[model samples]
Target chain A: MTVHTQHINMTRTPLPILPISLGVLFLGTAITMPFWGQAYWLHEFVNISCFFIFAMMWNLLAGYGGMVSVGQQAFFGLGGYFVLAMGNLAGVSPFIGIPLAAILTAIMALPLSKLAFRLNGGYFAIGTWVIAEVVRLTVANISIVGGGSGTSLTAFRGVDRVFRQHMTYWIALTCVVATVALILLFLRSKQGLALQAIRDSEVAASSQGVDVIRMKLAVYVVAALGCGLAGALYFASNLRISPDAAFSVNWTAFAIFIVMIGGVGRIEGPIIGTFVFWLINHYLSDYGTWYLIGLGGLAIVMSLYMKDGLAGFIHRKTGKDFLSIKRIYRSK
Target chain B: MLLTVENAHKSYGALAVTKGMSFSVEEGETLGILGPNGAGKTTLFNLISGDVSLDSGIVHFNGQNITTLAPFQRCQSGIGRSYQVPHPFGNMTVFENLITAACFGGQMSEPEAYDVAEEVMNSMGLTSLANQQAGSMTLLNRKRLELARALATRPKLLLLDEIAGGLTEPEAQELVTELKKIKAKGTTMIWIEHVVHALLSIADRLMVVNFGEKLADGEPMSVMNDPEVKRVYMGIEA
Candidate 1:
């Protein structure tokens, strides 16, 4: 009998050794950001962090799980309101409120999964959009959080402005790092493998013993938490949460932009997409609607030609399995 | 015994696909199901495997009733299967495909899953193609990947549905030889095939099913010589 040899390939990119050894590059930037960066850059970082986290969550659902969602902003708005209700009214720390918002989002997603899982492919995408719209309306009816107009976290304004700004920056950074790490860990786990399989083919994956519905539900909840966290962070920075702004569908649109440009189903895709999007917006900060037109056009081109996204393009050129979720196979 | 199907019947509204078909297999026995195209052969496999609901039937596997279980649950109970049409994970590599099944089906730990995947890849003669994306596989290799994925699941009863349908004669023969080798290793098998000769080469017994009914069954040659079986298959009794 021939026994197949299996090995654990646990080598990383040598832990970013060379660049870190060269000097403390991040240390300088981290130190300078709080002291010298303009209010505009501070505001930019807040939205960028949200974009990165939202994009990462979208990538998790559509890229890896192959569940394209146009309604993720539903959670984003729900999360912002959650933070406002918890942090300002309940007097909890905004940081603590963010996690609470995540928990709430995950809990909310449980029931929705039962309904959303019924729709397949494009229908599923549109179904989530409908659900998000329903949530937006339900929240708008409750007069507690300013109803349609929304409320502000003026309680935080009572504290020093500098203290608020610095804390918000760190909180946004934490969200970005934590979300990326958690998704990367999931991609390396059994559930992650199952998600990838379901993405390829539900029937084939089920035959292979993957619980397709359970896996999809798990991703749905995890992604909801990520969007919730981003929403909390977004609201915390501006002391204000409006239903229209917080629940805006454009959040999902922006996330799609980042993931599409960077690469779907790839870890580096969001990062690259976020940076590129920020750079483009940075340059065209004045060209209002034309900017939207150009972005929509870019996404069309990427979808047609760059099936793998930016990370995919790089992988093709480098011949590396950089973004693949392959097992740590053994040696002979 | 690895699996048992008793009085399994399936009806699509008024049309019945599987009508009270029953069978059982001990560990490592290769059971081949041969029938004409509309003979409910694939439906029968689907019923036993939990892919389709049985209108009136009971399926017990490893001494447990799995009639109401989900397909994934049946897989967890050591019942892995391959589709008639090869359905490999198109976006994943052949090795990744096996590993996915091995983790959930075989219930292997991380390192063990990797080891089992590598072993199954080599056993299925897919070592070099391990890194190849499954979507781009040639038909022959796609069939091999499907088999490897099922094997990686470490199922006690492996149900194959027309897996040898589109292969060349040599390829089908090689698959039969592979089946023999697998049978020797003590895994129970239920193979459905239209390649009568290839099936006869390895099947311990043969049964002919027609129009969701068992037309003839017994020893291979006797079943083959049955006038009714001939009438249904080629319209002539030799």
Candidate 2:
């Protein structure tokens, strides 16, 4: 029963100081933005946070879990509508409704996943989109939630405009922090290792005793909750909700582009991708149709030449993952 | 008996891969399986491991009826197997690959899983490649990983499928040496291999299968010498 174990040590690569310092500095600046920065700046930050969080979830589901879904907007729309319902009808504050709506939206994924799980690969992706459309149509027909015309969020009627903006900004910031922290913790845990293994090969993972179905379902639900939160947060700021706007496939499309351009599977990919997206959107968005065409073309070029995205390309060239999730062995 | 399969039958659209196959292995026995390329050896492994459902039969492991259990459930119940074509978790490091098996298959806690992974790596000569990505390894290392991963599961019964298929003579000999160390540990093993000398070197008994049926079963040398086994497997004039 004896085996050699005298010299080898098992450990994860230590987190480097550079990214940690930069992250703290960024958080500090973000946290103080409402006090020192202009209202427009705060609004932009909220928008950026929503896009980043949504893209991150998509990355988790597709990049890590290997379930490429094109129908996440179903939950995103549900989140927006739920928050609006609770606020306009039930008298709950829109701010409190965000998380409550997100949880309820995640619960909705359970039954939908049963149907979605029945399809795999390309069919799964298309099936999700179909499910989203069904949800959109069903919600549109409900007169209470405003039907196809939709409803505007009225819970902010009595609140001061500046205070509400500040509160919304902080809440969005909090979500970004939580999403990053929780997903990071999950990826570093033993379950995360099992998840990546499942992604690489489901048959092989199952032979190693991983419950592939359960793992995939868990990931799908988590992504649903995250996307829901992003949706709720987004409409809360815009103060408007409509079936077409909320359930648009463009939400998932943009997230896909970001994940593809940043990196498909790495944590850092979404971050870089989101920033690049914001830059193009801020500057080139004024070009209208040309801007849309440019975005599509860029995605195609990136997929063709730099398939790894920006972060993956850097890792290949430098052999360094700035935020490494790999384990290392040291000999004592 | 540690493992038994009774009256197993499987077919795909009229092609019967396994037909009423039945066998049993005692505790601490190394049973080697021999057959031609299309003799349904891998299909038999799949049925026993719960990867492929039997058309009609019963699989008993440690006296439990496991015919209807899922593959992962079977693995957790102490049955571990390697695919004929090695399927390592490509992006994960070799150490991480073993850790995945040890954690879920062996049902060990994180620290205990690390210990098992490290031990298996040491014995399997994978310690030096602990940090190397599993996908990028040479074929020999990947084959070693295939065996090391199954070993990390700490199974009561191990099923190895053609683990020595694509290796050179010296490399296969090295693998046989490592396997000898494992067999000495008294683990029950069912090995499907075309490398006759390697199988004969370790197996306590041998079974020959063709057309999904057991053709010969007994001592390794005698089974190989059987006229029927020679005619079917070796294509010899009977």
Candidate 3:
């Protein structure tokens, strides 16, 4: 729910300086990947992008819009399955299937919102989870997409190996960039401000003329589109799909953890949180249960102390927009 | 005349809060609605703001019946209100709070909204706190932020519910002074307050309500002295 409105008292600084540095780093990623890094760096890039996408989606639902969903992974799984089914059975190109998943998921989100909107606060969170489980279980029962066991895209692996790998890498990278960009843009729009106000207090927001129901539904659908597109791109890389992995709660888990750690409301929060999370996971994945225990411990501490998450904590401590929303915040 | 509410009725299970209530306000006039505790002052505000549906009534603004419109649509149509409990976007700056209202309430473009939010905040004495996090503001400032947010929408009819309830005398006076300025600007107001003196200063006409019914409606001085109004307030305050 980020909208870039112009204020009279304070003129927003031109091109937030924080994103300038981040932009430079983005250019560095594209420029330096092949020569400076090995197979491990590429793998890490994919992982980071995946986490980034999750954090962005979660932040959109919870922080600004006040939708605390614990089941966005439903779209992730749906996206993967949609691409797998299209590429294999319908003979559609996997690349074409990614955007197709995005479109279809957004449309499906309309009806899904009807059910999801019936609940409020914590109940809504669990209701979304229930919906995700239902989708997972239904997909598991279908044998067409390999049922519970899952299958590889080895059938289409013959199309092009090196190019497909690069395409997958590009798709993941694009998800990270585009999701952040779209969310920031949406926040500055009329609907975005309304959502934030509603998140603060639905009663007051509605009284002031913010259409809470319509705005909530719009974000719900758009978030689904983002997740669905990301999921499709994820499977497109692996040339494989399965019910458990595609529908895996890991997307939800990863997103929640990152957003909680990074920050909730601010635009740059998810990106910073994703990077920090990936760094921690890289160093600690070798530790097994203790790594999970450590993550749990971090969540507890952050929840108790850093209500705004890591970026919020940093902003408090430093008194600066370390990762400011581009084209906003700095206008003076 | 700008806005009117006729025969508005609302109930909570066995208790009817607003029973067949009716009132109207003219442009540039402040109408004080006085009621004892649980007398349905806030409930009426909620009805006009579109937070609660009427059991039976007609709410007309600028000649159109808006009883069926959503709260947000009401906002777009120039009906804005501040809550008894100031609910600011906790994480946003004070400026950000008003700017949001300008964007959604007035359907303003980016630059226009920025200007409107700034002007509103400045007039509300929120200039220094423009960059401060809303959650960190004091109670008086929180109330100001709420008022600023509502004002940012360029409301034709503004509703204020207990805005000065928790303030000290000087603070309440400051708020009253602001209300007087706003009233002078030609925006109609329906204010519900526990503070009698605050309402006595700005409200041209006063209506007293108790047990979901009107006891008096006329000049503030006369209504404030009404034996029935005195009995209700004294009885409830006791």
Q: Score the docking of each candidate (DockQ).
A: 0.59, 0.58, 0.55
Ranking by lDDT: 2, 1, 3
Real contacts recovered, all predictions: 0.75, 0.74, 0.64
Tell me the deviation in Å of residue B110 in model 2. 1.1
Q: Model 2, A107: alpha-carbon shift in Å?
A: 0.4
Per-residue error for A108 in candidate 1, Å, reads: 1.5
**Residue pairs with clashing backbones, model 2:** none
Candidate 2 structure quality by residue, lDDT tens digits, B1-238 = 9999999999998999999999999999999999998999999999988999999999999989999999999999999899999999999999999999999999987778888888999999999999899999999999999999999999999999999999999999999999899889988999999999999999999999999999999999999889999999999977
Q: Kindly list the per-residue Cα lDDT of model 3 for residues A29-58, writing each as its tens digit.
A: 764564566655666676577667767878
* Whole-model Cα lDDT of every candidate shown, in order: 0.82, 0.92, 0.81
Per-residue lDDT value at A10 in model 1: 22
Docking class of 2: medium
The TM-scores, one per candidate, come to 0.93, 0.97, 0.93
Encode model 1's per-residue lDDT on B48-136: one tens digit a residue: 77788899988888889899999899998898899988998887888789888998988887557777787888788898887788999
- Which ten residues in a row are the worst by lDDT in model 3 chain A? A1-10
Candidate 1 wrong stretches, greater than 4 Å = A1-28, A321-324, A328-331
| Candidate closest to the true structure, highest lDDT | 2
